[model samples]
Target: MWGRLWCLLLSVLTATAVPGPSPRRPSRELDATPRMTIPYEELSGTRHFKGPAQNYSTLLLEEASARLLVGARGALFSLNARDIGDGAHKEIHWEASPEMQSKCHQKGKNNQTECFNHVRLLQRLNATHLYACGTHAFQPLCAAIDAEAFTLPTSFEEGKEKCPYDPARGFTGLIIDGGLYTATRYEFRSIPDIRRSRHPHSLRTEEAPMHWLNDAEFVFSILVRESEASAVGDDDKVYYFFTERAAEEGSASFAQSRSSHRVARVARVCKGDLGGRKILQKKWTSFLKARLICHIPQYETLRGVCSLDADTSARTHFYAAFTLTTQWKTLEASAICRYDLTEVQAVFAGPYMEYQDGVRRWGRYEGGVPEPRPGSCITDSLRSQGYNSSQDLPSLVLDFVKLHPLMARPVVPTRGRPLLLKRSVRYTHLTGTPVTTPAGPTYDLLFLSTADGWIHKAVVLGSGMHIIEETQVFKKPQSVENLVISPKQHSLYVGAPSGVIQLPLSSCSRYRSCYDCILARDPCCGWDPSTHACMETTTATANRTALIQDIERGNRGCEGNRDTGPPPPPMKTRTVLRGDDVLLPCDQPSNLARASWRLNGSVGLSDGQGGYRVGVDGLLVTDTQPEHSGSYECFAEENGLRTLLTSYSLVGWPEPGPAKVPSASDPSVSSPGQLVLLRGRACRSRWPQCHRPLHGPCAGWS
Candidate 1:
């Protein structure tokens, strides 16, 4: 009895001491490959418009005339949106004066890159004019452009608060209700500012940099209207997305580092704000901000953002691209997270965070909140109480808002984690479009541009996100500055330092067989049984019911429908000396499929089994002997379906002399001599015993 009691006690103690399972950590990345990769040379449908100017950062789509307005350094071009490179484009050269350039160069700036008229802001001022701003050799200038003739007026407005003096500084603006709302840096060393221009009574952020805006790097801004279903009448609001340095240590909900750490944020202000009456005169009174959490522990820096605003404000969603800064980890990775507009609004309606003077840290406000709610837009209820605008708000409410601009609760993502995460790729910009499938479900098609000049086309699924394909848009790797999508034309316009590229959103012609088409899982494509080809299922295509589409499950096979396709390419024979290493090539069928090798009739190339290993592109065999002289076949398995991808015939002969193993430096060896790194469940389970370390062990495994 004593022994049994002692054993039970020990077991209970062990169970109590061990920590419960931690909350599920955010996914590092989705384990899948693009189904197809089309190089720049094979992309015949893509059109490009190149020019001598650089940094084509700003792009505005004019759907009225089917024109794409490109804002480049010292020039602006109007190209046909349907075909950007079809013919000659209208261009206007607007260079800064020599005196301005001299002054810019005298300030110790690089004349080649920095001292130039880089057009930064471009918006439609009206139906026939465009509001343009540029860094004219360190002197900011804004002017109106004649859209018909592509001509600039002689007079210009002083772009002090409308644009940034340095072309490299972060800036973003939008024109709404004849007012230009802009967020940019004021001067060379000043803190970032958000203000309204081209308005009768323009409001700006408070002068308190630490509490208002601290070293913010703006990415995107947009206007959102209230839904008509709501009972309360509210004003439309403008929201800005950016990354700023933390004002206090551990201020954000998920923050675990120092105060200097940067955090992604979303701030909003009402459009009807008329500034405080006296205390905060000429300053916004309904400004509030909250932190945006992408993932835990790392990958927090915001790189870029895009929005899919629907007719109903509740259905609007914002997608953001994030990466790990050098302060956290040194990996070239990026992640995409999405948030609903209602979730964001809920956070602002929650408790407010205030800096505690006693502890020198930020904490939730414990005092009573002012009436009408601090940082609330003017509503019908406020109007009934004799408050018409922000200027009519009481001083007590304004004082509370001035000190408590940060919200206590952070806005979490829609699915509680990132939609898509990728490693070894840095997404510079992204845009999304909604596509309704024949199955009565709508999927978002995301076009992500990487820093290496590749565009990844991915579709959001009920389970997660899947990358359909990747295309090399540019021959030479260059960062994509702007990406736009035209829904009516079914096209995507990509702007980079080199030029603009116009490509169709759907490439259904690339898939030859029903198996390939269904395996791609592209929402816009369907396998047509009549034509025996994969075709787009948009309204433009006929006979929609006859097309076979199984996006959720890609188990449909060619055997169930039409005749089997032509036989795969003939098997290739390779002759190798005994004791020599050889590599057999095989292409992957799709990213979701797994590849395995079969020798004769049995499975071969089991990891580290009999000197056989799997590589990224193919199978690698070492110490080749006559026993290996047999037919080898590669099979891709997905959704419990096995398909033959490639077949190889390996023949080995006795060596003339002593056999020598190939070294890394051997000129005759072409293989990389490295084994494939497993992903997903296998990789995670294998590394479960180890934790991420600052040095050695798992760090060197990769």
Candidate 2:
């Protein structure tokens, strides 16, 4: 009973262990095969838009108010930050009036019309006020505007100074702190008996000295020192820098001489200080006089100087832009110089002198020369009222910011020297120029622009800098003269010859990461929403299972249809002689199976017996004679089955042996008498055999 119980338990366990049909094995159909398909989902709705219309001279962003201000040759426009669409943030709002346009142009076709050859500069002092200057109308002026209204000031204030001569030039201006500064060229009254020598080119005569700064001929650029506290007695200072020709040694060809020019000088004055009162009262002072050689001919009368803050860490340094002439040709270059107010004051205190060694020094005035002084600070006589010369000079200094070797550096000039981070590129486009920097740990982004319509971005990195990427942000090529990067949202604003452009840094990063992969119909290394990670399609394992199943099914079907046909006909038998040959007939009439023939009882020849051939006749026996006689049989085979014996035959010839003979013991043995006796031999039952005579004599009784 115990053994039987154990056997029953085993049977029950085996029945339960059948595993419930493996839960249908979850077919591979659920995991679809990976086939290459176009990624339409990734590329559905990218947007592009038309940029601004006119070229721009300056770009400023009021982050607090969400407003963008752009300045062009003779126009200033505003844009609301909220109005910016995808790639369409550069729409224009308003333009400067004809009266304001005239200020930018230097050469006018008509008396009352504004000049087209205008030198215009723009700066934003605050959200509501922007300072602009031009050589048109031949006078320097400043105005305040409402940011929301986009309208110019109804009230105008004239500048303190009168227009200097050198009638064909323009002016550039800047706003630093609360003051406005400009760079311009002013002409001097002719001196009698100082006859200018005649040169080969029929040039105008008069030994007038040309300097970067003079009471009559100079422009100033300004910036607010937000990091520094405003002092009680010091005035808000604006700075100016330019290049000029050094004094000639007795007029030997100023053009032929190698060291004929220098980076002239820089001057600073209070915002309220202007004209002759502040200038003639000796209120303005000269800073560093750059001794480096420069070209004087290219910048003799008309030129440009620009300045910007260097680094965000410290605001003490500044960068200046100027044109340097090499071998009589003008090449635009920028200088990164260091300055301190204490160092400038030390030089001014000692240098009551006019000329340093034999080289002509600027900012000096001796009675009675026709040309403007090299570095003297000048202003309009009327605007200088109430300005005190005896007031203590403000300590305003500028310096260049240098970058470490490990840090990425900009390909173009920006600030003093841009810190250069990773993946930054200087790109030229139709909208405006931009310098882009990729996102990093400390800095959000860095941006820069150029006069040739380009924008570049760089990301800060510990090692060398990288140019992240670039894009065509505009429709046409425009001069991108100035640019500003917003601290609030890290957006880039560009000033072009046409207008202003604003680009969000976030948009740039997205475009760079997915643009090409989405376009080329390739598998994207992109974030997967379901998995929340980058994933790749599994192709290898999927293909292996599919291939194996297909091969197995194909093999099973081929074997099932192998042998399902009818039987074939028999093959004819053939016979052959020893010394000669005989013919063996092996005829088959069926096309389904082959036929085979056997000689005697042994397995012999077979032909066309496997359904491969039809209408096979017989086998040939060449030269058949005595020994070529035998029993033959025929059979057929078809498909996988074979026929036993369809035909049989025997080949025969006349036998040459004795049929009858007598024994020698008989009475006839006494004599040579022939005896007749019967002897029998059996042949195959199906065919005939012949009985015939023997060749030699036989002793027998008849």
Candidate 3:
């Protein structure tokens, strides 16, 4: 049966493969051809293919293995680069069955009702191993998809302990050195009562058992050191960025006033002691205390943090992204701050060394400096003032200055300051770029995902210098919580609302790799002996609109209707008005809610009542006067929503006058016989000659 299935799949692939240019078209020859400079028409003979219609929430790329992992709305697909572009990429090597059934199925429950597992984060451990986390599937899991057999290996392990809560909040994953680490939404007991807890705290904790992941606390974000030796030494640390209520404060106290709410924190655990069978026994040491600072206190909601290499010269320097609500601007904006881990450690230790009175040293112990607070290290005095322990307090220090010991005093230089980079919009989470410089200068690139479905790429050009790039990868607006990049393949994997998109660095103009080679027709396009494959350049024709259209077509098939004519015309309306009552007539059907009534373009009637009552009978004006003899527009609003407005002018006044009486004889004239006749003395002349005619008498009467 398996052999027959394999044969059927092969036959399907062969039938789909049509004769055309080879899938691996030479980039050099394609670039050499004269291309149109026009914005819309640039390529020729382009072939387009659509992947499965599933909406992906996360994307992961494995460079060493040359594989792309796309995590969609409820299913997962592994696609090869050779089968991605053109019509030839119709092959889907593997796919996770759509999670349609309820986790714990019961009788009478619909099994195919789509219990979607929205995959949010993906981390590549090695060439074959892959780790992924999803919402429906609350457990942390790792799977090895066989490259040759196109089947997932039976290596699923439940990560329920690490990711204890639903992923609706946010989560991120990083593969530092050998062990896989993830920063996920965790539930923990509130601080005051050890037995009964109310509110959950967002705390940074390691994957180890009892220490951080215990029922007492939850982790917000985690970072693992990439170096093997560093992974084992003091340098090999896992930093957790989270927000938790102060240990001493109660819920009522913190909740009474918004300012006393939960504060941001960082905790670190040494990697050396984290990976053994006794993992749960290890304890996490406190590193730094950071609070959400914003001008508007109410808008501040502690989300999550991302750690990035501050300067290219050293990997030890790190920066963090935090979300805060402030009145100074919109609540949706996010603020970021930079802190040297070494300096954070010092501040965490308090002003212990500063108040060196000799008699009683604050931080000094009888045994000698009680294990220099976990995150503290001695630095210049100016750098120390930048730390803010209060939630509403903003850091006074603008930037950090590196001082030289050779000088008599601390030399503060503004050129190389380490500070947090600010962004206009708020982002729920941030992911550090995976590029690390061991021997020479390091390149700092940080990826941030916004709540409005955008991926922001930030690169530290130098000390206190940065560049930001934003790209829209999702059609519908959905929150982008996590992001990951594969340095080996130079591809950016973004986790968005529906699914993931693999953005090749070659597509970015800054990289100057494939795009530049393609434009210049250089030898950079051919296959390289090292990778034994053609240089991959994503054609511009592969766009969201095309993909959406293909998906829609596949779903609708040939019976789909096509629009061939212009839209219908708008409806017409008429208005009528009386003394104080106005009638508005609408001819078109509508679903509008609220209608606005404007009188002579001056006073307008809305939800507020002034001198008018509006209803289905039209607008009713209580008192009628001559002054009100102007154009009165009556607007009808069903609900609070806006609707079509129509108006009529009552430009006349009521007057008193005699009433008209009808006549039966002469319909046109009434009471015409009421005229009085007078006879004048001149009529005496006419009396003698009445038969002669009344001309003389009429002359006298005239």
Point to the candidate with the largest lDDT: 1
Between prediction 1 and prediction 2, the one with superior lDDT is 1
lDDT of 3 by residue, 108-187 (tens): 33334223355555566456555554444433344544444445556554444333234344454555554555544443
**CA lDDT scores, all candidates in order:** 0.77, 0.33, 0.37
Ranking by lDDT: 1, 3, 2
Write one digit per residue (lDDT tens) for candidate 2, span 177-289: 44434445432242211000111111111122222232322433444342244332333344444434444222244434636443244444334332222222322232223
Question: Number of clashing residue pairs in every model?
Answer: 0, 82, 22
User: Candidate 2 at residue 627, lDDT?
Assistant: 40
Model 2: how far is 534 from its true place, Å?
12
Q: How accurate is candidate 2 locally (lDDT)?
A: 0.33
Worst 10 residues of 2 by lDDT: 398-407
Deviation from native of the Cα of residue 34 in model 1, angstroms: 3.3
- Native-vs-model 3 lDDT? 0.37
